[model samples]
Target: MRGPASLQGRLSLWLTLGAVLLWAVAAAWTAVHLRHEMDEVFDSALEEAGQRLLPLAVRDIIGREEDDSPDQGVATLREHDEYFTYVVRDAEGQVLLRSHRADLGVFPPFSGIGFADTATHRVYSDAALRGTITISVAEPLAHRWDVAREALIGLALPLTLIVPASLFGVWAAVRAAMAPIRRFRAGIEARGGGDLSPIPAEGLPSEFQPNARAVNLLLDRLRRALEAERSFTANSAHELRTPVAGALAQVQRLIVEAPDEDTRSRARQVEAALQRLARLSEKLMQLARAEGGRLQAETPVDIAPILRILVADMGRDAGGRLEVSLPDAAVIAPIDPDAFAILARNLIENAMRHGAQDATVRVSLSPDGVLRVVNAGPVVPPEQLARVSRPFERGATDAQGSGLGLAIVEAIATGTDGRLELTSPATGRADGFEAKFATNRIETK
Candidate 1:
């Protein structure tokens, strides 16, 4: 059979089992020893009774002044169950005196002095007056068995209470001893992939301290590596931004100055390529910001104004294709304004870039801090929709842009303990795409 699955249960079970086994062994040994001692005491009692009764029986026979051939029974003043009985006999094997309840059949032929065992009784015989007068004391074996049984029960009764108490004590001690490990596990689980702070290894037992130290060391290495990567990304993007913008401006100038149609068209293509590079670099910087440190503000603030400004800028560029709706009351939240803006911008841009060119994009923020951006477009397949949020993964649409939009929004949501969900077909719409962000960690009022 399988033992307990958990460490605490196994420890308590085995300890309790060991204690019960030891108790059982001790009790058995004690009972055997007790029975031996009891036998010695009972035998001594029988011997003493025979010796003391022999003289008194001789006196009674002599004082009777009657030459008796048949047995003479001693009279009893009260009625009781006599466990021990005795008989006085002559050398000729004639019973001269007997106890009130003595059965002559139980007394065997006396061979010599000391203890003897009959089938039904333990007989002790003694003689006086040169072996002519003899007395035998017989005690029933059943009476001895009864006494032994009661003594054995006395040794066992306390176990009923002791067993449960021992189990409880074992469980309590094991739980207390494992408390530090439990705390360590809770600390690790609470990190949830964002927080890489090392877990403290204090108060752990010697055997478990090494494991705790190893886990903390691993977390430290991961934290350093991630920080370095984010720093590299931010640096590369920041360095590329100025040159890419300058290149795009030069290409635009060349497109206007080119002498032939083919040359002008080629310059226009170069300008588009440079513009793509600049946007890609910008997306990379946003991704770095989204993946780095804290994303929440020190206190809650109304983020409605930031949303309005972004919608106006994006709408003006899109030729009035963007539609926005903001709550009348404050959309109070702890999310940092910059992070929220980046997230909102990415969602809005992704919808515009992927949706039909002339279709309207709907952006709205509910009173409870849920941002929904829906665009009229072809429904994305289930399998393709699943991976669209990954870096560098874009839809099959021919629109040109960096694919870090959804990825950035996802990172910000994860860091801020919010959720971002995308649907291929927008809820309550026949054919569209929807991105919903829930910052439930906000004040609704």
Candidate 2:
């Protein structure tokens, strides 16, 4: 069978069907019970009428024996023929008395017992007169049949009205019960994509409160996800713009000055700047993948060794302009090796680009499990300190660097359950960058 089109219609159909089935059962039971009771009432009344008529039958039987003829008794009984049958017989089995219509050949059957059937209630009775005489009474079943027919007719009209009335009541109740669900659906449809607020539960019934709350909770999560995506996009566009513009400017210079050797050397320098821009673009894509929840970094990693490798690589890349200071001890945390390398490389690379030339970059893992990357850079204003953590918002004196470097590091740290912090030097001389990871050791390392 085809299903109902909506919840309200389905619920209404089910309730009406159930009510009809129950009503059929109960109404059938009631009609049968009423017929049975009517039969009982009629049977009792017949028995009572038979009681009053019996003594008259016995007197006529006794009178006939004394008269030696039934002619006189028969004449007296001639007046009552509509509701009775009377016959009398002697001890010799010959007819002694009879009514005007009573035939000697036909007689009512008698069980000879003076009471009704113990199992059924068809009353029977016998009374003895003068030792040898007998009188009997019985109620015919035909009277009870007539009473049942009349009782059924009396109830037919009432049952007809009850069925339709009950069905309408059932439909009304089902509609009222499902009204809240309809309202909730309408509320959802009215909202546009940009409207991510939760559905209100005010004035709703208790049964629908949980449903509204659950839908609102799902909307709340979706809003957060959309907000994070918007942030990633805005930062990506801002960070990518400068490098693209710089590459365009260098290309224009190369076209104009290619014939001169001195101008060619300058073009080569511009080409190097273009290479740095390409690398920055690639790093931004990686950061987007990590932040957008597309990257899965579930693995055991030896973070200390990863950091040592990154420090060594950055030291080589920096030439003699940067020096590395490291702790003698090692520390570990669970992470993807590629992700850890990216994080360490970005943090150290950002420090080297921003700090003073020939400055010492301290790389240390505390015994209590804090990884620190401190470089001696110009102090950042307290008001501007928090802006550096966000993408595309670089500090003063760091104009040549891509703003995405710290943003990528922060994404990695957040994904791995670590914290990134930037602090001003105690004497306000240099800026210090620190990241702390929850500590562990790699079983394989």
Candidate 3:
């Protein structure tokens, strides 16, 4: 099966991804804009330098023909200037004055008066000395790229560190915001069947208050419905007890006073039927009590005496078919005395009724608060066992039962926070049924 997914984890993941994506887009836009702005500033500087060299080139041109040699004045401008070079040409397109670093022997052939590009450099040409002189200022494309790259790196460095830190902050905030939900879940889980009070909405976030209120409304409805059902069951069982007992007493009298053998036999059958009805009524009362709520007062009760009394009562009917194995000392557990007795009685009675006629039924209590009733009988199928704990369900259709025996026991166990385990064919006995009760705490004294 796939594992459960977490809301907090998914929210954090998507939030972080969104933040990273936004940051990347912002950074890319900044880089593009920064590169464009740097190119403008560098290009403007190139044009200004060419204008300053125009006057110097005019002076050099006038003295050039007299000297018939290249000027040395432009040589000093080349020093410590790796990113820019300049070439001044006459109107005839012959080189007039050039920087020492301008290694290209021929000046750029003029087509117009603006920026142009050769294979290695970007050239800006301007007419100076009243259009008599042409000045070209060239910068290598490699050097221009280096300047723009440095500006882009300076702009991006801080965001690279900020993005990871921002994501971490978002995760922490999300977890802290979800703390109230965790508290709400824990409060609900801690409640028992007896706790039907509405959950308090105080101190919860506004976003969660509606959910809390809705749950409280549901709990209120459930408590009222359960109260009504319990009231009906208790009143009905109480009302039937007196009438059922009166009828059973009348049947017993009929059996004793019948004048004919057939009449007496028929009266005896009626008595048996009345007895079964009485048992069913009693079980219904017990089930209602168990389901009403948790025990009001829990007291340490010794189970040895109770178990012995139950086995003795059952043995009268079971004769030699009953067996008992009690712990040497009393087993003490926190439980309701009436509830425990009812649970044990139902289990022993079920064993006697369903077990093979000649097979021995054994009732045993361990020092650790495990009470077990085992009897030789057909094993209950696994599929049926899963559902047999429900009311009015028996191991076999032919078995005689009110079908509330195991259901009552299960309810009692749940009220005391105990457990009931059923196994068909008790260990080492292939044709036996075993029912075990495990209380929450057990003490032997």
Compared with the true structure, what per-residue lDDT tens digits does model 3 show for residues 203-277? Answer: 778988999999889889998888888788888888888998999899899888989999999988988888888
Q: Provide the lDDT at 403 for model 1.
A: 81
Over 4 Å off, model 3? 1-10, 45-82, 85-121, 125-137, 140-168, 187-193, 205-208, 296-337, 362-372, 416-418, 425-429, 436-445
User: Which is the leading candidate under lDDT?
Assistant: 1
Which of the two candidates, 1 or 2, achieves a greater TM-score against the reference? 1
- What lDDT tens digits, residue by residue, belong to model 1 across residues 1-445? 9999999999999999999989999999999999999999999999989888998998888777655655889999999989889999989888989999999999998788988897889999989889898999999999999999999999998888879999999999999999998999999987744689988778999999889989989998998999999999999999999898888888888988899999999998888888888888999999999888678889988888889999988887888888889988988999999999999999999999899888999999999899999999899999889999999988888988788999999999998899999997999998999999988687877
On TM-score, the leading prediction is 1
Q: Clash number for model 2? A: 0
Clashing pairs in 2: none
Tens digit of lDDT per residue, candidate 2, span 208-324? 898899989988898788767856765885688686777767676785768988877777777777767766776777676446542224655445667677777777777765544
CA displacement after TM-score superposition, residue 215 of candidate 3 (Å): 2.6
Q: What C-alpha lDDT values do all the predictions have? A: 0.91, 0.62, 0.81
Least accurate stretch of 10 residues (summed lDDT) in model 3? 70-79
TM-score of 2: 0.44
